[model samples]
Target: MNLQTKIPLKPNTYNQIDYHSKVLLLGSCFSENIGEKFEYFKFQKLQNPFGILFHPLAIESLITNAINEKEYTKDDIFFHNEQWHCYDSHSKFSNASEIELLQNLNNQIRSTHQFLKEASNVIITLGTAWAYRFIETDEFVANCHKIPQKRFSKELLSVEQITESLEAIMSLVKSINPKVAFIFTVSPVRHIKDGFVDNTQSKSHLIAAIHQVIEPRNHNYYFPSYEIMMDELRDYRFYKEDMLHPNAIAVNYIWERFVQVWISEETKTTMKSVDEIQKGLSHRPFNSQSDAHQTFVKQLEEKKHLLQSNLPHIIF
Candidate 1:
């Protein structure tokens, strides 16, 4: 069955599927927002194997810790700040103990390999083209400064490199789950230091790279998260206090936009109507009644409010 509503691409309808399916989100912090909304929608199989930030290194560490049966604690961590940890593109572990936490990392990848073997849909949120590599093994280390930048190298990636990385990752995903479909999105949260002009360039490169890889493939695809953030929530007011990420309202708008693409029209209409009714009830003006008449009057008011308004207007 077509999971999405078949509406015209121009002015797509805001409808998503009623029934939830298992989903795994791996990528940047934006994926966290997507995951939270899925929870709101009560998606049946939402999973975040890589946790927040969706950094490959964090996922590797998480898997390692799970395999070794050792806990991943701060003692082993070089960075404890939630901001850096959420999407650990530029963080690291303090010592060998942190590395020890990753004993199960490989095992978990093997398990992910197994699970994706049968997954129907998988979403990957690509955050950046910059990754840190260890000096010795040429492996991408989770963090650089936790050890030394000198011990590792900063490899700024091109769009081609990102496309290759996603392709490699997707290839692994497909090997484990042959029938799985893939969705790729570039994160909207800005890395301010990348320089305003440079940051914009990087995003363009990333998006272009992702499209080049996925556009020709029948099974792979892309989502316009970058466009929505840049075009829909262009104003600074839509951003959080930190001036980087989108606030709740902006995130909601993005979720709604996504629903237009992934959800069914019928379900969208029903949900919209329900939301309207609820809003109307909440907006009913203050009322008064005698103590003796309180319960009866309140009940009548609620019923009247329900019957009188088919659509509720938001006070704002």
Candidate 2:
């Protein structure tokens, strides 16, 4: 008897990702997990250049700003907890020097602009519909930068608002790169801090908004990452000790499913070669000067050279 319920999944008949595909992944920490898989398989990809943006409006702002090449100034950032922080970006961009912070932000803008123009597949993972509005500025902030609660008001985006935000993202991206494909997925990491019921509502809104824009005939698609986590891997065992994010095993399961549906068959063979090279490169020998170890290192270098010869964009 079948013990598990699986979502019906099939390989994409067109626009499948290969080694040559320049994939740009945005939004949420879960997007990093999938990005790691792409890095492991030596695929051409850029992940979260503005850091992990959790909501569609933040992503929409990023797309619009990047396309317009918005330069960050001192006014765009604030000093918080003795560090400079930008409300439009994750705290990872925070720095002790305000000048450095603004420079980094503007640099990312130019780089994101370039990568986005060349990207073939843009995979966006939405984490939550809940957002924080900085009351003083009357604008939604992507991150609160650990500021006190009273400084910002919390709000949940309606499905219609999210749909409009997503549409704006698509439209802006298409204006620059008409052939780019979009794969939208709701992140499986439950936002428990928002309360259990609120988390469900937030995810529901994100998924509903995604469906409103995804059309296979237009090269816009949705991947059921959240559903697979909720149903197929429906157990506390699949989550980390925090009991929220998917554990590595669960991420691997979801990744394998993604590969089956989106990765090209020819790319799978290249991935195997890349995986073997990766494993070999990471191998540590007990004896550093041994002839056997030296031979192994040489052989590994040769393997890297061969792979790089074909895929010059890849580097170990």
Q: Estimate every model's Cα lDDT from 0 to 1.
A: 0.59, 0.93
Q: Pick by TM-score: which candidate is best?
A: 2
Q: Predict model 2's lDDT versus the native.
A: 0.93
TM-score of each: 0.65, 0.98
Worst 10 residues of 1 by lDDT: 86-95
Cα lDDT over the full model 1 = 0.59
Predictions: Cα RMSD each:
9.0, 1.0
| Clashes, model 1 | 20
- Per-residue lDDT value at 243 in model 2: 90
Cα deviation at 121, candidate 2, in Å, is 0.4
Report the poorest 10 consecutive residues by lDDT, candidate 2: 39-48
- Model 2, which residues run further than 4 Å from truth? none
Error of 1 at 243 (Å): 1.4
lDDT of 1 by residue, 26-91 (tens): 767898888886655445344555444433344434333333344333433343432223122333
